[model samples]
Target chain A: MSSRVEILNDGGYRSDGRRQYELRDIDIDLSQQGTADGCCTITHGLTQVLVTVFGPKEAKMRSQTLHDRAVINVEMNVLPFSTGERRRRARADRRILELAATIKSTFEPVVQTTLYPRSQIDIFVQVLQQDGGLLHACINATTLALISAGIPMTDFVCAVSGGVHSTSPLLDLTTLEENDLPHMTVAVMPRTGKVTLVALETRLHVDRFADIFRLAGDAGQALHKEMKRAVKSRATRLVGAMETGMKPPMGGADAFERDVVMEDKMSF
Target chain B: MISFASFPVPSQNETQGMTRHHPDVEDDIDMDEGFEEGFHRLTSPGEPLTSSQAFMRGHGTYIDNDEVISSVAGTVERVNKLISVRAVRSRYNPEVGDLVVGRITEVQPRRWKVDANSRQDAVLMLSSVNLPGGVQRRKLESDELQMRTFFEEGDLLVAEVQAFFADGAMSLHTRSLRYGKLRNGQLVTVPPALIRRLKSHFLSLPCGVDLILGLNGYIWASKHVKQSEQEGEEAFDAEAVYSNKNDDIDDATRLAISRVSNIIRILAAHFIPLTDTLLLDAYEWAVEQEGDVKDLLQADIGDAMIATIAARD
Candidate 1:
């Protein structure tokens, strides 16, 4: 596809007329009904991610390692009906493998796995429908799942996939957008505003790396704030349902508590 | 052909936004084909259920007899703050003692979590279950979970409420024969609210055969209780006098009976398909056995169901 510069440009903006650094309309909630430890449903444009968490309990027999740290087990279950026409089941596909591996590696530094030594936490992320910002949606949903599972984390890891289109870098690239261009996913701990993880899948002009990287980090920051409020509110609502004699209430942010909250709030 | 004159258009959200119980709720409760809608009786049988009506205190109190009461009519039993009926009601909440059909979702170590008769997921402890070989135990051994097969995900079970824990969630038991994994039958979930609890789960359909599920919603399919079987039937009239004499009957008991009656009524209306499956299957099986169908029909059914069927046939 040639960069027609005219077809790619409209209203001095993208097809959707979204200014650069502008996020898509996002709908996030826990009000919906679904069976999962913790479930978060996010709709960014048409992209939909249903994230569910299962643990913080004793580790499963298989995943338990001699090391004291809790291992994060992430499984991405994308429904066949998620995409148009039909989508095939993923049986250890490279994409899923890469996704799982990347998530585990990225989250290891954030999740307070040492708190629940020998225990395993299972996070299930499903992309029911994809438009763009799947990595961002995944991170957002994973944050909610972790909160739902009552797992501790250092900060909310908010991420977004972006690409440099016209002269500026785009934020939260959808599949249609990513297909014809270079893409990069940047996950950052919103509170610290540090890029915790970055994956540039396709070739991009070397010089534009700095610019694309900055925009993704900015998207991640914006996303982390949104995800933080969501998790804090969800945790607030879980007050009455807590079985153990109440979790020390989360209100004012202390140093360690803030770090834990931020990490738990951010994920991919 | 169906006539529009007889059929009334249902209102929107007629079933939703039911604020637990609200005054001015005297709209006609279309009894037939209304099990899926959540409703539970909040009153005991023979307990003059009331509705909002401004009556005068003439020589005590009386219904405004002068009013042409066409929009309302049921057994005119109560003339209190509001009017309710003894005919049939629906279930609204999870009662402690009724039998329910539920799905086992999570199998935990000491207890298996079940979707209580609705409302919330309740716990079904190993102690509550009827374990094999009649043994008393607390902790569940790995083998026990395999042998008796307590419950795996997606298993529909019929269990009784042993008790309710502090959280309003119930503790279910399958110790009795009626309580266990449901098999070879279709499941139809009615709102836990609309079931009307009768003293007995045994119901006699217009078709003549009687079915007794227990008050706990457990189904005991059999010919209706013979008139002779109810020969010494204590009239619910007895219950009226009993309730009056025993004002101390805990609110829990009254609430429980109301809930039970409501469940029964909903089941009767909505379980038509379930009943059809049961009867049609049995009828088809008997017909398939070939030999003498008469003997098969007469074998399990008493003379009365036979007589009713013959008459209908």
Candidate 2:
């Protein structure tokens, strides 16, 4: 009501001209950043987040180490300019801490931390821009970063935000639509179709909750395909680069002998 | 050497030739079909590789519902019947006889916790090190008390991965004279996979720099120390090996060290593999520019250097 921009237009389209089930374009970049073991930058329309994963290595703090499993530490920083209105949030802000905790809990079961005993895996999520679906972008980026780091996991966790606008259910609400609607984020492990996380901050009717939750879960599976393709291509490129480097340098007699053997086998 | 001498090459070649001629041989069919050629197909987590009956689950893989599925996104590699996935980028997996450079994180009772960029802090026990004086010396209480004197917290050292502990943590040893506390240079960290196993990891560059390419991606670039001078008359001189002091370094050597270190940083940034020949070629190109060593870090210069190296190859 107070907002001049209509959340839903008369043509059954959102302010962004998207239909009820239309999701934004997703872009994923899984590239090494600095000293991080693995880093990924994901953009869901205007919302962008960069997640960097370090360790499964020595835990810097003795108190944080687990006896039989690795400790997961997630630190999130939301840049002041991330939102439409520039406002800086302190590192220990309650909302930021809550977001970090949500991510940590969501990944706790999926990451096979027991493989690394007494070590720590640090996930640093930096929000460069925020539109709507911020949590979804963060979770998806973290999943890719963890995989690129070679951390073992049960399956890929894909997340999506869904909301119910009046009588109709919407998928991937933007910031404007999110502020006006009752929305929730759902994360699913696509391999088993099991929901890992369902975070809802706003109140919604019992009847509407089921529709949005189910829609978000299905949208997550679609997002999973896109993420899987990105991860697979990245892995392939890296393995190819490594093999090219591993090729025995030319002029070595050892390589010549191997080539001779290959020729002999091929001739037969 | 003796094993090779025992097996005559002519007979081995004849058997290999015969095996190659037989297409019906199921055992050798893999080689004939060229399945071993090229890189293994890559697999993502949750993607099934094969049935559980035919393949054994290895690292980076798991079994679910009688199917061997990959647990990590990586290339699928099979050693006979044991199938595993080798992650493209991962923490260093230390093996026996691997040279590694690590910073001492904590000096415990008789062991030093070294951060070797591995999953866990590598352990350097008092018994594994060659204390000053003699190579074979019994452990002493005083030695235990003065463990920090040998390797204090934050000190970096080059050592060999001697063995593994029960928990799979690596145990490093500085028993040899060549392996000891590092000084007079800087350390450059890169992806461990970039370092290829070679005949000799210790290289004394012609430009007055000594390079120790640790398989763990902790490369030590330092002022060249003559091999004979380092050994000295006393092979186990604790004073020299355990000394915290850095010797006087000339300005030229200092410049060369920075140049080499910068070249390594650029190469690693581009995800290029580091090899002696490739590095030497890069250094030569960098020097040819006659520009400041720091200039090599610039985008244009770095791109040119990698291009020249790739062209030469």
Candidate 3:
């Protein structure tokens, strides 16, 4: 109703003070929450999503059990207060169910389900807050949670939202920008640079689609770098804790040299 | 209450520097120094570990285009010609004869589905359990009708992984008297990886607590049951074994059991490998503090407890 708010200002800066291609700050927390096998809380600026993965365990419903491989069940909940308006959405809301279905399909091929036969993998995605990019955050957090749960996945999936504001394409659209622009979310597998998901809800000019898609893909790769670092850092701490007694037979000098190299690379 | 401190701001570079340097200082003189070196050698999912021809792919790994790539984000382990990556946290992968404590989720014909905190519910067949009359008694159709009388839904029991079914679901057997309905205790779960294998999974502490360390990370701490008492009624105690009764546990025994369970919970929260010695050391340290059992969960007290346990090593 209010068309006075500016998404992209005349100065080439977005309303959130980010440049056209700049992404929002990403924060991830993989600490344990309850008895979930693995769980992660991820934030993309104002959007926050917590995903917990349980199983490759027994399926509660025998009818849903797959004989040749594992079954994936994804359930998503958007809190009433997650959006600007405090609106309560039903569990079977069409939009919410579609979102959950899209996420399940995105991860189906990536997860090596055949490795686990006659079991089920449950992914519970909770959207605590949202500005934009809800699907992107959910998909990304699910990927990390699955890895934490030790379910084998072919690769890490990184996602980002991109939109075209008039002629200038924007990366990581916020809710305000999303309302006024034609936006799409893209999820990419960093290892193979394969696009796992490309979700476009708004219609844009045919010529503009290729540009936004390529930009989202490139942004996905950048997101992948940050996500990979967080996962590897946590893995290092845990693996170190498990291997305390077996000090490298060589002197501390060799190990220190290796750490220095790691440090140098990490400095970037 | 949601705290802001829980969400550390978006300083990736600064946080990375801090994390790396903090471990750098601790690795040199820490008892767990070897772990730090190993951590650096860990692999992320999809990272090529080696050629498929040279290394056989194991769990947490897959053969992709003639290259063995990691399928989980964790440390790569090589045994003989087989290579695998072990995720830091995961569901318990049960092996034959491993001890486990599970809660019955459902009761079906001749079989009870037990949630063992694994990838699937482990199967506990009617024949796998000893009937109240005798171990040698035949499992008649009448026994099938009274399956709920044996191990009903929501009943927790201790059993061993009998074998694997055609589908990979583990079949558990509770035929042994020692492996039967669990009572007089509470279950505490931790990450499965933290429970290292020991010669004896059952431990009776001098503090009047009995500990059953299930490899599935389902630990049971209960009031100590004397071995002599067990032997005296060894025969014809099938009724007691199948009984859903909790013998009157005195206040003192209950307190001791709770204290030991709390200690295990604390140890698990810190990701410390739980061994009998470690638990013994932690129990002694907790008693020395002379504080309330609940105080052990406080952050400062928990830190001090971890420090005292580490100091002992």
lDDT of 2 by residue, A166-191 (tens): 88999998999888888999999998
Q: Give the 10-residue window scoring lowest on summed lDDT in candidate 3 chain B.
A: B1-10
DockQ values of all predictions = 0.01, 0.24, 0.27
Alpha-carbon runs more than 4 Å astray in model 1: A1-11, A32-35, A63-67, A236-268, B1-313
lDDT of 2 by residue, B117-204 (tens): 9999999999998887787678899999989889999999999999998777999998877788999898988889889876557766
Candidates in order have lDDT scores of: 0.51, 0.84, 0.82
Residue B257 displacement in candidate 2 (angstroms): 1.6
What local lDDT does model 2 show for residue B310? 79
Instruction: Please report how far candidate 2 places residue B91 from its true position, in Å.
Output: 0.7
lDDT of 1 by residue, A135-172 (tens): 76787777656654444455567778888874567777
Candidate 2 — which residues are off by over 4 angstroms?
Answer: A1-3, A246-268, B1-38, B232-234
Q: How does model 3 score by TM-score?
A: 0.88
Checking candidate 2 for backbone clashes, the offending pairs are none
Per-residue alpha-carbon lDDT of candidate 3 for residues B46-140, written as tens digits (9 for 90 to 100): 88788999779888898888999999998777777878788887889999999999999999889999999888899999989878766688889
Ranking by lDDT: 2, 3, 1
Cα lDDT, model 1, residue A5: 36
